[model samples]
Target: MEVELEIKGKKLVLQTGTLAKQTNGSVLVKYGDTYVLCTVVAEKIPKEGLDFVPLTIDYQEKAYSAGKIPGGFFKREGKPTDREILVSRLIDRPIRPLFPEGFNYETQGIASVLSYGDENIADILSIIGISAALTISDIPFNGPVGAVRVGRINEEFILNPDNEESEKSSLNLVVAGTEEAVTMVEGGAAECSEEILVEALKFAHTHIKGIIALQKKLGSIAGKPKREFKVEHGNLKDAIFNIISGKIENALFLQKKLERQQALEALFNECIQNLNTADKDISLEIANAFDKVVKKIMRETIIRKGVRVDGRKPDEIRPITCMIGILPRVHGSALFTRGETQALVATTLGTSEDEQKIDSLEGEIYKTFMLHYNFLPFSVGEVKPLRAPGRREIGHGYLAERALQFVIPSKDEFPYTIRVVSDILESNGSSSMATVCGASLSLMDAGVPIKAHVAGVAMGLIKEDDKVVILTDIIGMEDHYGDMDFKVAGTEKGITAFQMDVKIPGIDYEIFKKALDQARQARLFILKKMYETISQPKELSSYAPRIYKIQVKPEKIRDIIGIGGRVIKGIIEETGVKIDIEDKEGIVRIASSNEASALRAIEIIKGITQEVELGRIYMGKVSRIVDFGAFVEIMPGIEGLLHISQIADKRIQKVSEVLKVGDQIPVKVIEIDDLGRPRLSRKEALKEIEGKNISTK
Candidate 1:
């Protein structure tokens, strides 16, 4: 059946009786020509006490939708791209939080793009499709959430603008929410003012409400009855009340931040310890309940009371300290700490040969710059087995990488392979932002001429009733209690990257704008502090290698390469330096540990390829001596015969008497054959010497 519904600010048309009818809950949704098919399926049985829902959201794009083909060996769908993973996260973020706690259902949400006009964004459409599917599916969810993409162009806000319109827009913000409040936001912007960001958010919320309403209307027609599920509320509730009421007086009066945490930990541990002496099976249950209770109280306290556990104001940033060039051996290094979140970021500069090669759907490619983020368990006061980077690490690294990508100089401009490594020494919240700050400082310290300094900040929000407070430079606690975690990163002129994840169905435009505005203010402050330490790029370290670039004629590439690359290899071994030669257009780049090595290599290259100049004396070896002339070898493969008459001013004897094979001689070039062979004369060499002697006298 075809269903039509209108909610908040969007109109959704879902046709279930037609397309993708095989899936459990498949609906083709149209939001103007941009179409998406959302399919949902649930596992027959849930894992015991999984606690959280196993909800996987996958957003895949078909090449045919954009009139392109898969460009790889497989020629079909493979692993997800970074773009797909990001879009999947976008669809998953708002929906994940909307599912009720303790609902351990294994559900999957897949939004596939069958047709795209390149006008509407697939992300916003996917959000609508997911909501529509869940509203109609037998799955239980506290949802009907709506999402919208808001942009600011020419000082005016636009909703669901086409791809072309988004290019000119300053902000690319996605806001998703229920009727009451927004739960998620994600966006990037030009360095817009705080007021402008706020206004854009408000505009988005008003329109998104319409989308939410549409989902509810669609559910009314095709929705299934929600299944009955137990929300576990055991005797732990009474135990939690007793513990909090008993300790509320002391917990509320706790002054020092660490002491408060210690006291809370002691209280929770005491409850667990007591439960351990009780029944063993119920002990696990009691511990889980106690942890939940403490978390609930902690969240409630932040929302009901104006105070934070860390004792900082909502808009106050943690103490920041930045230092550069901490590691003497590295090309560049910086230690950036905001509150407790610390990142030791280092930058290494290398030649083109050291550039990273990646195999992707687009085939093998070389990247000039790379950023890696490492989050060790010890950074967050935990211990666990070490493993490779998980999805979170990849996502975080890409976020920071995108933030700094715009400022990095192109390979042709900088001619250096750049690698940035961020190690989290301590993490509270927004450690990724610390990566950005550290990366910028480290690049500057390495003498990388970035266009401008970049900085990042994570803002948070707390909403109760109609009142909302936006927090700047949030800590771990604020993030846990907060409804939104909006991270913005950019240079002083414009935003480079942004990500927003909310705990509610969605946030309003006003809240998002306020958080972004606050983030900008905090970002600027952090940048200023960084500038105080080092305002501009310094000279590269003396230990760093020196690089030289040389371009040769395309036809001469083979000559320089010689047979089987023997010539270039010989040059490297003789000079004791590294050389990279591109044979396509004959561009040779030489890198050496010191200037002398580089210069020596350059000289050797010039001697082999440069044309012989007239009057230039070259030390040559006599190859064969005949009566008529002595043939002398000048360059590697060039030989010239000097006539016996030109061997001396007054020669009356055989040439062998004066010059024999393997005799070293100094020769002067007097003429060249039509074939461009050097004609050497021993008489001319003697005359030149006599002229120099006369001049000296």
Candidate 2:
């Protein structure tokens, strides 16, 4: 059966009962020509000891969907790209919380793009597919959440703008929610105002109601009978909470993080010992209930008493420290430490060859500016194995990359490929935002001409019946227990990147706008401290290579690069420099450690391609001494014939008597034949040499 939903004057189609029937549930969602097949599967047996639900979301983009073959050696999709990982994250964030409490059954959801379209992005439709699949399956999902991409162009908001239209818009926001409240939000903006962002969310929710209604209609018929699973239920939760209520309040009152955690853990262990039970399951449930007691006390304290874990005001920012040019040998480096979160970001400048060549369904392209984020378990005071970046790392790195790309200079202005690697030495909360802040400082430290300095702040919300407290610069504990973790990053002027994940059913614009306003204040404060250290880009590191770019005639490119690259290779080998040439604009970029080598390479290129003047003189080489005349090389490859009379002032009977094949001598372009070859005269060169003839053999 197929259900149609009209949202913002656009038609969305959701169909089921046709594909992947073996799975718990499957649906094919189409918006215009774009469509995705989303399927969900739930394991029969529950996994053991999974503190959280074991759920995996995979998003794959097939090249054949767009009528193109994969470009790599495998000629097929092997791993998920950053975009795919991020979209998977986007779809997972909203629905993950809506599952039943303590539901730990293994579950997996996948969205496979089957048809590509030019008008819309596949990610938004993938969200719809996931909701539809889970809604009609036996899995207990509380909602059919609606996802939409909002755009801002000319002070107007657009819902689900096409590819071309989004490029021109200043805001690229993806919002997901049920009919009641928003659950997930992530996007980057062009310094858009906070009011504008709030309005976009409100606009998105109005249409989400229609999508939710359509899903419920399909779910009424296709939803399978709810599956039953057995897990021991415990009644000790209330008893454990009452016994630890007094100790937990004092523990949660401590100002220091580690200090508070120690206090709580000591009380929890003591309570377990007092129970003195041989049943391990009962003991574990009691321990979990003790932790819940802590969450409840902490949230209530902040809501009723207006006291935070750090004992700071809800809108207060943590102390900040910024330093740049810390590494003398690197291109650019900075250390940005805000409270406990620290990011040591290093910047590297490279040629165009360093750009990342991404092969995707759209086509192949290069990314000049890349931000790599690393978060080790030890950064949070834990020891773990080191491996490749996981999904969280990729997602955070992409967020920082999106924030900094806004202020980075264009390729036309700065041609070098820029890379910033942020290593989190310490983390408490909002380390990704810290990476964004540190990367901006590192770019300026490396003498990258950025438009403006950018800063990021993490905001938390504590909401009770009618009261709400918006916390600024939230710490890790607050983020883990708060209602919302709203991260907003941008310049002092406005927001650049925004991300939000909510724990509750939904958030209205009134509270959302208040959080943004609070974050704006925090952002300005952080930027002020950063400016005091280094306001703008300093002088580039002396050790860095000097880059020089120029354009020449398109026809002259062949002359510089001889047959089989013989001439350009010789220039690099002799001058000890690097050169890159482009065929489109005839652009040549030369990078060298010293100016002398760069100038020498330029002279070598000009020697071969320079237009020959009629009366010009050149120091020529005796390439071959023939009987008729010795062939002299006036340039690298342009040789002219020198007759016997041109050898010296005194007429020589034989050319070898005056010039040998390995000899160096002077020559003049006396005339040119009709075949576009130059004829040289040694006698005319001797007159220019003041009649002082020096013989060579």
Candidate 3:
């Protein structure tokens, strides 16, 4: 079966029943020659004792899809790349919420790129394929979600813009939704206004509806009967509520996260003891009942009295403190604390050699600015084995990096490579946003010359029937209970990065607009607090290596490099400096902690690449004597021919009669031949010196 639609003059094609027939559900999505094959499988029975579904989305990009072989030793794709992991999260976030509550089946979805045309990206197509596959299969799903990437290029919205178009665009907004409302939003912009973001959302939804209609058409003919699944609701709610009742609400009102958590744990213990049941099932029932009551009371209190768990208003932010230069040895360091969350961020400056190289399907690219986020087990007060960064850490780091990327200086403006590391010292909620704040401060502290101060805030939503409450600067508990987690980051001018994921089916336009506005206000407030500590970039740290830049003729690049880089390496060794030379533009960067060493390296490079000008005088050393002329070394690598006729006013018998090797004498560059060789005259240089001396007398 096939369903096709033309979006923004590009064809979107969906086909099924011809491949992966053995799987429970499978679909192949094609957009502008890029194809994604998505398949989903779920166990018939739920995992025993599992309260949540164990679903994993693996989105892999096969090298063969792009007509290239894998570069590594194994010659095949190994672990998931960061791009794959992020795209997998994109597909999982929207679809996971559509599954019925209490469906704890262990499910897995795999989206493989079958073809990479480079015209259309496979990310959005993967989401569409997964949604279509689940809709047609026996698996229970309440979705035919549509996704579109919206790009704005001159205030006009473009749907699913190609890679080239995306570069020219200011906004790269990916919106995913069911037919009725948007479910997920993830992408970044270049400091665009909030209203502009809203318009983009509305534009994306229009195209999204078309995608949903196409999915529905495919499902109508090939949809299978949903499997029989029963959601068991506990009847112990009333029975357990009598035991905890008024105590749960008071426990929730505790000011601190630790205190609130301890109070809840104590109440759960009391409730379990009051039941006094040896039966394990009764204890589990009591636990579930206690959770439901806590959730209900928290929501009710917030809606009725406009009070939060921490005794703040719905829009109130937590107390924040920003400190800089905390670490003496590092290039730049800052400690940003907001309520219980804190991030210790440090920045380091390096030369061009420190740039990161990324090999992807498109091509190889180098990144001069990098941000790394580390979340230790101790930060959350948990004990877990230390290992490589998990998916969550990478995702958080990428978001914070994107948020600050807009403000980072260009390579031409600031030649040094910049790296920012954010360590989560303490985490209750919004550690990622705290990282953004700390990173911005540290960049300024390192004298990065970023455009503006960037700040981030995590906004949340709690909806009960018609009552929707938008939360600003939410803590961990509110985030866990809320229906939406919307993170927005930017400068005071506009937004730079944004991501939103909702547990509910979807959110309408009104909620989206309100969430963005609230997030913007929160971000500005945080920026104001950050500026109180440090406003602009300061002087470069004493520990940082000073870089001196100079450009030479492109042809002279090879001369400076010499055979096997011997010439440049010699300069670095003699002066104790680091040198980077660009071949095309001949831009040489000399970096050294010692100012004298850097200047000396620059002098050596200039001498090696300098050209001799006609009619110019230079102090020359006679390097070799020949019958016709003598070779004089004017610069380090440049030599000029001083013929015997031009050596003196009258002709001499032999070149050695007037001058010999290793003689230092002033000479004039009389002429330069066609082959770029300079002819030198010692008589003319001596006459000019004599005339100047006579005038002074």
Tens digit per residue, CA lDDT, model 2, 1-697: 8889866455788899999999999999987778899999999888764446788999988888899988779888888888899989988999888887677899999999999988676998888899999999999888889888999888888888888889899999999999898889999999888988888998888777778888988899788876766555665557777677667777877876678878888887877886647755455666666766677788898998888888888998878999998999999999999988999999998878788998777778799999999998888878999998989999999999888778999887988889999999998898999999999999999999999998999999988878899899999999988999899999987899989998888788889988999899899999998889889997777877777876787777887888999988988999998998987788778888688999888878767776655656678889987778989888767888888877777767887677778787778889887875788877787687765554321
Over 4 Å off, model 2: 6-11, 47-51, 68-75, 225-235, 614-632, 639-697
Worst 10 residues of 1 by lDDT: 248-257
Error of 1 at 565 (Å): 0.3
Clashing pairs in 3: none
TM-scores across all candidates? Answer: 0.78, 0.91, 0.97
Candidate 1: residue 354 lDDT (0-100): 87
Please list the residue runs of candidate 1 whose C-alpha ends up more than 4 Å from where it truly belongs after superposition: 1-23, 26-39, 44-52, 58-88, 110-136, 142-228, 232-239, 249-260, 270-305, 584-586, 611-697
Poorest lDDT segment (10 consecutive residues) of candidate 3: 688-697
lDDT of 2: 0.86
Tens-place lDDT per residue, model 3, 1-697, is 8989987677889899999998889999998879999999999878654556788898999998888898779898899988898899889988998988778888999999989986656999999999999999998898988998889888898878888999899998889999888889998999989899888888888889999999999999888888878777766667667877878888999998889999999988888788755655466657666777888889889888889999989899999999999998899999999999999999999999899987678878899999999999898889999998888998999999999999998887899999999999999889999999999999999988999999999998889899999999999989988899999999999999999999988888888889888888888889999999999999999999898999999999998888898998898789999888888987888899999999898888889888888888899999999999899999887899998898988878999888889999898999999999999998989898888762210
Model 1 RMSD vs true structure: 5.8
Q: What is the lDDT of residue 688 in candidate 3?
A: 89
